[model samples]
Target: MSDPLRETDENVVPQGIDPLRATIRTRFRRGELARAYDWCLEGLKHYPDNLWLKHRAVLCLTRSGALERAQTAYAEFRLHEAHYDAECRALGARLLKSEALEAPLSDFTIQAVRAAEAYAAIYQETCSYYPAINAASLFVLGGQIERAQPYIQAVLEQSENAEQDDREGAYYLHASRAEAFLLRGDMQRAQASLEAAIALDPDNHAARSITLRQLRLLADHLTLDLTGFQALEPPRPAHFAGHLFAVGDGDNQMTALDEEALRVRVREALKTAGVGSLYGSLAAGADILVAEAAHDLGLPFHAVLPTPSRVFFETSVRPVSSDWSRRYDACLEHAASVQEVTSDRKQVGDLHLNYASRIAMGLARIQAAALCTRPLQILLWDGQDNQADRGTAHDARLWRLSGGEQVHLDVPSRVRYRGAGNEGETADTPHFSQSLRAMLFLDVMGSSSVPDDRVPVFVDAVLGRLARACEQFAPGLVYQDSWGDGLFLAFESVARAAEAAVTLRSEFEAIDFEALDLPASLALRIGGHFGPVHEGRDPIQRRQSLFGSQVVTAARIEPMTLPGSIYVSESFAALLALEAEKAYRCEYVGRLKIDSQKQRQPIYSLRRLRRPETSN
Candidate 1:
């Protein structure tokens, strides 16, 4: 057997889903259901691996009044396989909703009974509100009203406790309540619930469509029934032209000709994939060429440095070429930001280089995952495993986990080259853009005073407590970083981020100092801020680091808080005020100036509203 794809292969097949977004809505709304259905079927032929389009095809077919065809396609959906998880099962249950409406299923039919059982399974596995509602709908449709009422009651109890700020969660909760009311022929209550659901997510196409249909049916004194499909927003991975790439090379110092050859390969791959950004460390060989190519294209090139700037420059950078330091400086100058892991001077050994490469790859993975795109790796090696230099081979394994293809730029001894890339260019200025997100900063107050032998135990205990606190409050902690006694975390919403800060204070209070620290001064001071952050890699650390004004605001607010208390910026307070399940109260602390150039920002002290224990 021989490998079909090689290092120089340029034939690239792009995976893009963004085109289907507007197409589905436009075609369906125009009453062009057949065309929409055809488009989906044709797309799946070319892209047979696209599960989303297959699901879309079934929905379009069902909506077009082709019941039998839709049912067959739905049954054959790949999601029904044993390998898919509860979430995928939930999606299937959701898609089945529309077809069930036009079914006119009788009480004695096998299909009707099986439909009800499937919904039950989905509800049991996911604990999602919609599935429970759908199960009740099935029972009601089969003239089993008594069985339906209990599910409605369960929904009411859960709705009272559900977090209202979860846009998607709240949408399903209110919509399901509407479905229950509709089943009972209570049009008034049903209409009100639908209105509430639509208010939560104005962009929800299904909610709007169903609401309009319900209004028309109510005016004509027609009976209400579900269309079957929940039509909540479908989860789609990102489809972008550009991919983040990594550069790794052997210990063999690449010559000027090797650098030029590498540049040609990198440039071709970037052009072929239409890459928008680059992420990696800046060593003498392949790294410099890729960086140069990325810079030439006016793309965002991020440089991840493994150690302190001067030490890294002194050993790994400057020694390669006196002019290499200037190129390194140029890369830093052009960067949107710089992350320095440690300032301590150390040898720029192979181990550090290996560690640095891993970090760079991690950053690339984070970027690709965030956009729902596959990560890419670009290796600079001759495809030889002579020694465990831990550069190209390690990257190849990492590339598989990252989920993308690779372009190996072979560095042979005899290689031809065109004119070399400019090694010195410092005149260029950087253009930067970063999205806003909520950040929480927690600094353990004075853990450094602990004896040298006890420091590790103290740090471990603090980290353990922090982990437990996050699991309690922020169930899905997305990003976190730490150094010494300080910890930094990031979240997509203000509610969870704020809850984490408040929970840390409350949870720490319940901890007795006698057990772990043997000191009373050890306490946690927390701060929270909501604003924009550049979620990119720290050049020194190699992993993703959150930075910018928001991060600075959070770090500054942390120290201002009273020991064992949480402080949040007014921006955070504004967001907390919007949450229906607000777990804490904030009293204005006053405006405090952090620095001379920075304006004085208002701060609020947060206190937890203890949750009452549920009666079992």
Candidate 2:
């Protein structure tokens, strides 16, 4: 049998068929679990009997935090299997372990012990070190250290005789040995084994992340010191920002020599920073140079475009030069992923560009969190502040305000440039008429169900509570209004909007419907977006209001948002990353249709970040 992890060639397969297994495996390996799960489902549509795809589908769902769905999928997968093999049994045990981890305090130990027994049974039947180590770990977590010893010994014994030729296999063996030693209370040997494991495959970020999580669990439960393991996490992710070259300005245009020098400087900065992955735009000048340098260094580059590809290329790339356009195309083609902040073809001043930059920064931060490391911002700046609120200087300021690490590469003195297209503007140039703002739309879930007699109660219990929540954020709240069950709000920043959304959701959930004579089904659905909106006074209400395409976009997202949860547009999530690095988290919930045109928009579930407790 061939190795399932090996890449498959599409040319070798029949025409008109996708290499589904290969596509899914590639996405899975890149840590794109959501996309991998999507591909698995698509593959299943064509080849329903494909066992490998079926198994991977369950794994993707499990890793993506859809435990309930994974459990149901695993059950269906087991029914299709002719026999209960080691892989099948291990997968079932894995699901049980996940559920136990997510279970409430009352049921944690019971569920953990049940999962441990399942793994132990599999280990006894197959003598597999994988199951043996898992059984030991789960047993420990279940508060049965004494019962965990036999399985720990089994793991050490089995791992000693396991083959070490494969890199992945060798890493796992050392990792298993480390876990076994930790279980046995042999801290010295466990540390040694862990060092060996990390040394064997330092670039295995996903594997390192899993090991770190397991170690954290061990440290918390077993009271073991984890200071030495801090350095074993993956390298920091880098966020790149720089000035755009002025194409038509003879005095400010970046020459070939300047371009090459900047590229060299970027390459050195990336290497010195030990960047594992890169996130930025694909604009001309410094952005493309960073992408090219990262690509040459074998680091993954994720492109976050402000607008559609064609429009961005025309405005930001092609106008710079034909050569720059080609370079942009090459970098974009080789990018690990490409995300558009907006589908709009028209550029609205510098709004979209600034939004895209913030999103890129947020994405880098997200990747760093996943790999258990911090994010670094690398700016190729001229060290000069400009009148415009969007550019290298702005980005650097934001990074500093967020208290993130940063490296500045000064632009060559000979290559002075102005803002892209605002060549004749001075420091006194007037700002854009529209300013970036965060807009939120919320709706009461069961408002329509209230009878005439209960209307007063519904308004008092539901709307009254919401009004109180808004009061807490009065400084950040720029505008607010209510019409029946619908509520509209505008905040000065994304961070404030996110905080308010989370607070409203939590407060609404805590409401006692029984005491208030209201239905238990009443809930709140909220959606948010960050963009440039026209701020003016409303004629009908005779009050200040925010109205623009962005406001409309925010309104559309609320209807698609699920009740009792907050869903935000991609731009909103990105800005949250820039403004509040560690205060919130945005999990991608896939693209959802937000309007009648059936045009789908990427949405994320918003939640407050809970700081982890330090182990004593």
Candidate 3:
């Protein structure tokens, strides 16, 4: 039940027609057209009046080269009297214009009858140019260039009147003029008109495709070098004739002996090198025999053991000029050093988003787990505690939802809140269940140097604020997990999550984040997804956690969200609609794929911050 157009099979009736139009423009992208068409038909049987579904089916049929069938289907849709007559008409007109039929079609066959009607209703309708345009296309297709002249001229005059003075229309008009000019061997005017068309729409795929063909033709005629404009760049190697080795208790690891063995392995591996590795991190090596072998073989001897080597010697180097503004600045001073290549790109660049997402997801699971089952508490200890314990306090926090309210119960004093379920049996309750789950997401903004003695204190302050906020709103909301910078929380309802997110933003933004020297201002982007999930009982495995497509999509939404924003799935928004009105902005981000057979589901973004004012 994701997309409204996605209908189940047994609901269909043979008498009903599926009006599915293809939106994917390329044949290569239509791999599942048949399946999509079938699905549309199933949907049509249940909702026979849906124009979009019918239009999509018609488009699919036409694009599959089933033109006659497409024509018939279009007629059927028109007979049913759907609300897409204008669109149907426009597509029909294009097809007729392309084919240039000799006999006039019946009124039902003319798809864009509305456009024709509209034109006639307007001041001074003329069929002279319209028919001539179609006639010229037919003549040109039949290889009768001379006979098409009058038709082409008639179209040019009519187009001038139809286009008025819009710049957007000028290029199309010029394009038609150029085609006629080319047919007549008027190369100068053709070229001029072609240039004008390109100026109007640089990225117009059709124009670009045609322009490329024309350029290639001109290149062939003049015997010119067109290779300079090719899309590919020259290849460069990380190291020339270098030993390719892998460590970690493997035979590939280098030893003090067996020079020949190492040399053979390196040569074998290097033979398979294509563009060389895009990026890599290697360890250092100080073996003299290895170094001597590299020196003798004219190979780059970069360290391959203790990371961050500084050697560079590779064959077939990329050429470069000294000018800084050229395609690539090849100045010797700025070339990648051996050490730079040895630094793992994943460790430095890839982990940021990964850590953040994992933290957010993990926290959401914890909250959900707590809500469905137990009175979970997140005991967060800071640097001060760590320092006092010599970094052994394991600064942790507890978050959970109990009773009908949410709560963030934390450490020190035993703060017990009355939760659902029987009294003594409650402590033994499972962490995850079938109950509704909430989500919590956190974003960290401040970085401060907290000595071992002071770290616990710093963590405590942050946890205290979170704990306080949960208490003020809903009780028993448990801490889910922490991303590198932020935290994730789970709740019983989306309203609770939305309220928590807004409150977190208001509180976090009000803080003096700059007091701690950090790279950038701290910010947050929060998003939540709700659906059926398998909840785990154990805190470690947390199987009761939100899993599969819905969770991943919710995680992705946060990245697309602006800082201090909270985005929810349409399901969550609908659930919240019956409660209090939300102050946040909402948007429909169309349907997204959450799983197989689930598509076009609505996603909503709830904006928390106001648009910023720019200084004049």
The C-alpha RMSD in Å for every predicted model, in order, reads 21.0, 5.4, 27.4
Better of 2 and 3 by TM-score: 2
lDDT of 1: 0.57
Give the whole-model CA lDDT for all candidates, comma-separated.
0.57, 0.76, 0.39
Compared with the true structure, the alpha-carbon lDDT of candidate 3 equals 0.39
lDDT of 1 at 201: 70
For residue 92, model 1's alpha carbon misses the true position, in angstroms, by 29
Give candidate 1's TM-score: 0.34
- Segments in model 1 whose C-alpha atoms lie over 4 Å from true places: 1-258, 348-351, 385-390, 402-404, 413-616
Q: What digit string (tens of lDDT, one per residue) describes model 3 on residues 188-293?
A: 6666766766566543432333333333333343344434322211111221111122223334343334434544444433333312111121212212222333
Clashing pairs in 1: 97-228, 97-229, 98-227, 98-228, 98-229, 238-372, 304-539, 305-539, 305-540, 436-532
The runs of at least 3 residues in candidate 3 whose Cα sits more than 4 Å from the true structure, single-residue gaps closed, are 1-432, 445-464, 476-479, 539-556, 582-585, 590-601, 607-616
Which residue pairs overlap in candidate 2's backbone?
Answer: none
